[model samples]
Target chain A: MKNYLENINKAFESRARLGIMSVLMVEEKVDFNTLKDTLQLTDGNLASHLRALEEAEYLRVEKQFVGRKPQTTYYASPAGREAFKSHLDALEQLILNNRQKD
Target chain B: MKNYLENINKAFESRARLGIMSVLMVEEKVDFNTLKDTLQLTDGNLASHLRALEEAEYLRVEKQFVGRKPQTTYYASPAGREAFKSHLDALEQLILNNRQKD
Candidate 1:
């Protein structure tokens, strides 16, 4: 069994990063603008976090044009998905362990 | 209904803080030593995070003498408990919503 403390992904430590993962988990693919609006993050803020996730290989990015306007899209990689699930599992495990002490 | 994105507590943003709340939620009260050991955090690191949580009113601290030595204990305040639960609920909602897209 994975220890709860050790299983948490530090990459998801920020609320912004965590929120991004949450949206990606369901949507599978999200545009930079949409993600920024949904998470209410600034352009630079969202970009930095996205870059971090990308560097960690937790997210995949694509740049495409819509009607000649450039659009950036993001998707959670397979490793990203597993890391997120494990993080959620760790959270649940911690909660359950605490509940047992009640 | 609380908007899933806005409901997440930024106060629980850190892995250490989240772990602290997790331990406090079930145990009702945990000494600083136990928390430090359980989370494997450095003394300064734990103190900084604990101070942050306490400042946010998510944790209560009590300093007293255990035998001849001074011991500090921590507990999640009512607001803290509710906040953590809300954060957890938001995470679950995000996950469930993602599952539906599958």
Candidate 2:
């Protein structure tokens, strides 16, 4: 019997991190303010989750200037996208497998 | 914006507990030994995860004897089923929302 649970990644366990990845998965790039607003997270709280994902090498960050203001943006790296897809696939499997029994 | 991430329960964050719930959701009653084998979890590991779910009122346990051996069986509480369904729905929403953008 295959253990589908093994495919659930701990890195994406937190809702905050999950939200970040969910947004990044679809959008090519999301700025700090946009992400913070979308997820409705405090600066500190969002920053911490972003740092955790970055440390896991699941996301890449970019800093640049928009006009006179400094802006930070995030992107889902190839590795991150691959891992997130696998995690999603595992969740789908868990749900589908149970549904079949019902 | 309705944050689908908000529907993701912290209780199901651990893969072990998730596996336990996934199994319990479908099966009416599962013995401790059967759960341990299905999830490929050690006794201590499975016990701890079971305790966590029990604490959350997500699962119910019944203990009795069959022949000369003591047997423990588990069932997913109504709350557990509801919570797990919400989590699965949130994951499905996340995946579907992103897919539409592709």
Candidate 3:
């Protein structure tokens, strides 16, 4: 049987943004440097993408002081979580369809 | 509860490519012109993307003659279907997480 692909299509929005979402999806909150290292993204590039997601309200950012330096952490919002789940379901169906074909 | 976001992140791959996958997910088979119109993509642009997808083995193209003209139909291959499904699953989780926040 053929699987539906709407969520798969949505997956094509932006690679960096997607990565950020993935990282944020698992951890309750992640530090900026850790995210950068994990995703191997340059500071500017990561900041730009994070700004976009923040603007879309998919993520929330918190800034604070850690010792003498500044720290920024990110977390996924509830809406973002729901969107991801639905997208996952659609993707799973697509995979199932392909497996059946094989 | 906090939701995961890997699938949501995967949704940012490519808008047009995602759209193509979305349409194919529901339809058993789709024609080139129909896909072009549905996506509102230029002939060359659509053809280029289709070529990439076909190359990736995500889609299959069948060319035939309809009446006196040529017709091309496309379908998602098994691998392509699986990839698309996994991608969708990631995206759905992202959305779900966001929704819960509200």
- lDDT per residue (tens digit) for residues A30-91 in model 3: 99998888777899998988887777777889999999999999998997766655655655
- Interface RMSD (one decimal) of model 3: 7.4
Q: For residues B1-102, what per-residue lDDT tens digits would candidate 3 score against the true structure?
A: 223333332322665677788778778799998888887789998898888899888999999999999999999888877778777665555555544544
Give the interface RMSD values of the models in order: 3.5, 2.1, 7.4
List of clashing residue pairs for candidate 2:
none
TM-score of chain B of each: 0.92, 0.91, 0.80
Ordered from best to worst DockQ, the candidate numbers read 2, 1, 3
In model 1, residue pairs whose N, Cα or C atoms come closer than 3 Å (at least 3 residues apart or on different chains), thus clashing, are: A26-B98
Tell me how far the alpha carbon of residue B20 in candidate 3 is from the true structure, in angstroms, after superposition.
4.7
Query: Tens-digit lDDT track for model 2 on A55-95?
Result: 98999999999899999999999999999888878877877
- Candidate 2: which stretches are off by over 4 Å? A66-69, B66-69
As for model 3, its CA RMSD to the true structure in angstroms is: 6.0
Worst lDDT run of 10 residues, candidate 2 chain A, spans A1-10
State candidate 2's TM-score: 0.88
Top-TM-score candidate index: 2
